[model samples]
Target: MAAFDELDPLSGRKVLVENNLTFHDVTEAVAAPIEIPNARWWGFFIVSVMMLGLLLVSLGWLFWEGVGIWGLNNPVDWGWAIVNFVFWVGIGHAGTLISAVLFLFRQKWRTSINRAAEAMTIFAVICALLFPTVHTGRPWFIYWPLPIPNQMGMWPNFRSPLLWDVFAVSTYFTVSLLFWYVGLIPDLATMRDRAKTTTRKIAYGIFSLGWRGSTRHWQHYEKAYLILAGLATPLVLSVHTIVSFDFAVSQLPGWHTTIFPPYFVAGAIFSGFGMVLTLLVPLRSWFKLENLVTIKHLENMAKIILVTGTMVGYAYGMEFFIAWYSGNPYEQFAFANRAFGDYWWAYWIMISCNVISPQLFWFKAIRRSPLLLFIISIFVNIGMWFERFVITVTSLHHDFLPSSWDYYSPTFWDMTTLIGSFGLFFTLFCLFVRFLPTIAMAEVKSVMPQADPHFGEDGHHE
Candidate 1:
């Protein structure tokens, strides 16, 4: 390992040079000062504490009072709970998508945000799990959905979308956590070195698994990460497609469309990118990482959002066109009634937020502006929620019989539970930011132009 002592051509000054540092150097740099405070931190703590209390209270009530207290009835049995489940799960997709897919593409910007984004993925999956787990009424017996034979000799339905969701989501969460944690090991080792207290050192030491910055370790680590990324790309698409199948597999008129898979995948990426932007924009600024993360990273993400948004819009059009072409009066009536019927307001909001609002990003100015990007990200989340609502409630509310048609609304408990999920999300994210290296510093440093000084000989960097 040699230091570059040559004069610089760009600035005509001596280049600052040192022994070439490994990934360990970069990881330590980012993890060293990660404990800074922002207003969002206090807000996150307060909100999370309150939400935790609410979650405890709500769980107690659900157990004591029974599932009857929920707004679910025969026709609309799957209401706010299911909607929020899909919403949060969709939120979970953004993180792994940003980390794994972008890694595969060699997108350098992903390094700045992927660590936190992947952590968010894990937390969002946790929140998503609560819905189905608790909503089962007999939460304990929920395991009957697994393949194990019970005393009654009944097995879980392999054909059921619910079962598919169980396998898909569970596998997705497990793999994503593994990928995220594996990526964090080298960084955790860096933290261990910088740990102020024995406790911190021990904790990070255990997490780091005694990682040493040997060339052999880096070789194995890089290979493992690439394989994990390959595993995750399909998992990302499969999880959401299975989620869509939870609707599409049903015989319900509006829900029976074949276009749901691609549509749902696009919407997942759209919403996922939105959630990533929402987290990173404030995070980069608050952490004083302007030079490291950079505006160009956010701009790249906005372009992704734009592409995904357009795909969602195309899906919407395809759904409409196919509904008309299918010649099923039930399907036709379902789409029409969704737009112009009782829940028309919800439908329009979905359109405006998801389909219309994102089109503004076509302008480079809006795409690059952090403030506008933040606002659009919020819109994307809102629109995604409405998209799930429109798919679930709208289709189910108006089935074949006119008499069975009804409206769905979130009750008091429903509202609390949804908000409480947000608390859970932020709490996990805030803890991750405070404790772990928020940026994948090793990966970022690897891509920086100055990381390799051989550029003068090969002229590859210029």
Candidate 2:
């Protein structure tokens, strides 16, 4: 309620375009944070920077000590590092979903939030990359993936899922980056045109590629964006599928299931939208973007979370049934261990967060209540992380060899490194909103009615 005061002017209407905001107002609202960030923005920025500092310090310590500083043992050699990598990667999925899939389907509501979601995808991928890089321990020689000769001159096993990850993740990052940057060109041009300082003008101009908003420019922009969306849509499915391959191809009982690909994809979008909700709810409130990022927009995203969450829950249930049906005792134990064994806490937390909490969206009021929506989003994020933890650690810790079984516990460095990734993500995001327009000003304009277009006063738009 405190942050969403801007919505009061709309009375009781629900539309993609709200409050009769002029194009000037749209551009100015988004640009204002970049031009003159307030104290609250500074507070968030500084906190994120501090977390980024933690990341650097922890990474430095990790580099000095090696992966041994982590709580990796014979049973759980793959620890939070892999879990964090998948978690971050999954978080990035919602961006492409919003930017590409929805756009391809002509969902105009995406216009208001796609820019920030796209930025979030980029930042989330950056964080995802950090874990696997450092997880190698000898990150300096990480270039072994290149076709060139290394110290040993032995080529990496191309069959390795790790290698697949190298290609899958790199491709995802490259395409997502290009997609995000292409979308920014017009907005960068707007900033350049608005610039009062020569330095700012030059900086924005260089990136904007001399975008003149001409008919030809718009035509080319639309074509390039469409092509990139086509490219990115499949990457959304493939990237996470490949990431799941890191487990699915393994002989481990819990990981070897065929269900992992679609399951992880569903979970990824589930968590991705959860993160989008977490960030945007507060952002729209803080920046007074309620008109642009309307309740309907939030509700649409909530519906996605609802659908995906249900898909994820179904996948969870099917995994248990598949295990039992296989008549493989090891597989049976793997699923049972997840629920009733050492990691039961993580399993139930995942269930509550990913499965149960999203059910609240069935109630219209809950989806529309920003505070309630934000709260559930937090749960969804927490639950998704626990889901990854359960999937990674539970299966590994209690594998076939009972003698090798050991409880996994993260060391201080491990915890710090995991927490620090958030710092990197938020720091990038803080800088993004502080410099770039958070909302797509150009796209939002297309949705707004120029005529006396207050929502049909009869409440039909709702």
Candidate 3:
């Protein structure tokens, strides 16, 4: 086809994909990673397993001794475990937002990143679920949170916010898993048809569900995907809303606030997109995917980070405003103490990273620079974790009675457990990239110029 650099007055310039690639080129590019094993992948996978091992060891010791191994104090009953839980849960929000919410709205840019983002969502949620179970100090009794009929007449209290977490997160994970799986079927069929080995053939064939790419198959797939997308869009809002309830419903001075729902939701999408940048930038280089992912996709995500980060900063200021406006001494002290008191260091870190760093994305160069975007994204992840820590630890460090107040500090075990959760997340992600097509091959093809019926109009094509 002849080169066409035509521009529409309305949208300026747009390129969801670069490099003038055809359908076969997209397939070869995406399938290269799975077809040829890389040494870098093995190294990444090994380190992840080591981290997973540490998590296992930490949990084993926790089960043997108790939750007392954590740095819990008189005033601070909840510690890093709860903070990590919230952090991981927030890290999962962007996946569903990109895949389900954006898909429903017909955002074409999501085609490149949505598959990997969905996998990240599943892994992050798995890491999030671990903390609540272990935090109870009895892994064996973890099932007590479920309603099981028994002669003792004991059942989970549905009224508890923690129980609501159980329901909300599980439902989010289930719907996300199904949605991700459904999207993968067409691509899995591609992998199945190309598999050379019996093991690969069997694995891909089973997961592909005998997809033949016929007219009937495409019809069912589109209808099913649309239905699942509709089902998943509400969950993007509801899951985080329920999570915020864990703090908002509390009577504690710092924790009691009405702004928590929207604030937490915005922060979740903010942090989740941060993580997507952090993971995708390096892989984009390692896998030679810059053309496919393109500067446009990265910039769009950066724009989102800037927008949500601003909302989060607004919430921060709003919290202080609400405290002062409420005329409650306890609420005022909580806000003041968080900013200027004992845990002041953590609070400022959250502000500088979450609020300040994302502002740099407002610049055209920084938003388009993959390296700079990666750095800021790292800062976003750190700031978001600190945000959760501040929300959890600062509020509990000093309660109503000063006599029972104390400074909260994490133990070595706390450090290990937190790092190990990263291990689990990366381990699953490494496996995903190795075995499956990280980019959605079919979706990417659909967005190409050759897929358009008007490609040869005016004899533009050779």
Lowest summed lDDT window (length 10), candidate 2: 1-10
Per-residue accuracy of model 3 over 268-355 as CA lDDT, tens digit each: 9999999999999999889988777877788899999999999999999999999999999999999999999999999999999999
Give TM-scores for every candidate, taking all chains together and pairing residue i with residue i: 0.92, 0.94, 0.96
Off by over 4 Å in 2: 1-14, 149-153, 450-462
Each candidate's clash count: 0, 0, 0
User: Candidate 1 or 2, higher lDDT?
Assistant: 2
**Minimal lDDT window, size 10, model 3:** 1-10
Q: What is the C-alpha RMSD of each candidate to the true structure, in Å?
A: 5.0, 3.9, 2.8
In candidate 1, clashing pairs total 0
Q: For candidate 2, lDDT tens digit of each residue in 20-58?
A: 677898888778768874899899989999988999999
Descending-TM-score candidate ranking: 3, 2, 1
Clashing pairs for model 3 are: none
Global CA lDDT of candidate 3, please?
0.91
How would you encode candidate 1's per-residue C-alpha lDDT over 260-300 as one tens digit per residue? 89889889888988998888888877776655555667777
Which one wins on lDDT?
3
What pairs collide in candidate 1?
none
